[model samples]
Target: MEIAQNYLDSIRFEFERYKTMGDATFAQLDDSDILWRYNDLDNSISQIVKHLSGNMLSRWTNFLTEDGEKPWRHRDTEFEDPFTTKAAMIAAWEKGWQCLFEALSLVNPDNFDTVIKIRNEDHTLVAAFNRQLAHYAGHVGQIVLMGKMIKGEKWVSLSIPKGQSEAFNTKKFNK
Candidate 1:
């Protein structure tokens, strides 16, 4: 039981970390920056965000009780950008994370052993968590990388800045 509780706690932390990383990346970009893509085939930050939000809404709503992939979700359509500005993109991002965190908060030791379904496929709760974590983390990486590219030398590092690892580790060791 303690292990289940700990796992839930850690998973929540991981989700929040990913969300924070994306938020930090967004903070450095302008409105037009969010919509920039390398090519027509590449997805812009807005497109990635829309897809993430749609996936979160479908997968987290009534999560354990219903299929994670809701019938109403048009996965392809998520690539379409409805956001014209950074604020709109941020709103969607926050709403999606809200749904995810709310659903996660409901998971406890009692239900941790149950299986959840996504697209009619069975998944242990741990598997579901790992799945979403990987998906979101990948998108967050894209957001950060693109934001860096858009900002060039002006981009601020979310983690340790380049060439500062020695200083970072020294501070850590001293602590």
Candidate 2:
């Protein structure tokens, strides 16, 4: 039981950290940057956020009682950029994280072993959480990379600023 609590706490921290990275990346980008794509084959940052939110809403709502793939989810359309403003997309992003965090809070040790389904496939609650963590983290990485590309020399580092790693580690070990 204690282990379950520890794991849940750790997962929440990791998710929040990634969310901060994405937010920081978003702060540096303009409207055009969010919708920019390298080519027709690539998705822009806005499209990635849309896809993430769609997945979050689908997987987290009625998470324990229903299939993760909600019947009403328009998965194909998530690849399209719907918002021209960053604020609108930020709201959507917050809503998605809210759903995920709320659902995660509901899963305690007593329910941690409960089986859930994504597209009719079985997964334990922790397994589902882990799967989403990996998926979301990958998308967040794309968001960061895209922001850096768009901002060019103006981009701020979200973690361990360039050429300072040795100092960072020295401070850490000294503490």
Candidate 3:
């Protein structure tokens, strides 16, 4: 149980970090900037948020009992322009992460070896957790990168500022 609890805690921490990064990024942009896509073929931040939300809800809900891909999930539709406002997009993003954290909290070490199905394939609980973590992290990186591109020089660094690396490293080394 301790293992499961720890795993859940780590997942929560990771999700929270990503959420914070996303919030900071969004705060740097206006509605128009948030909605801007690379071109006609790329997705905007709004679209990515929608997709992440959909994935989180479907995969986290009944995670152990059902497939990661829910029957009601329209995966392709998530890419379309549905979010009309920044508030809506933020709400959807928070909702998805909330679902994921809640579901993860319910897991225990006892279930670590439990087999879960995703897309008809069975995976151990740990494997499933790792898979989702990788998936979410990939998207979070994209979100941060896009946010930086949209904000340009106005973008605030989430981790470290330029020319401050030596200071940051010194602090870390001292610690």
lDDT of 2 by residue, 32-98 (tens): 8889887899998999999999999999999999999999999999997567778888888999999
Compute the lDDT for candidate 1: 0.94
Name the best candidate (by TM-score).
1
Worst ten in a row by lDDT for model 2? 80-89
Worst 10-residue lDDT window for candidate 1 reads 77-86
**Which candidate gets the maximum lDDT versus the true structure?**
1
**Over the stretch 70-172, how does candidate 1's per-residue lDDT look in tens digits?**
9999999999755779999999999999999999989999999999999999999999999999999999999999999999999999999989999999999
**What lDDT is reached at residue 54 by model 2?**
96
- lDDT of all predictions, in order shown? 0.94, 0.92, 0.85
Positional deviation of 111 in candidate 3, in angstroms? 2.1
Model 2 residue pairs with clashes: none
If both were scored by lDDT, which would come out higher, candidate 1 or candidate 2? Answer: 1
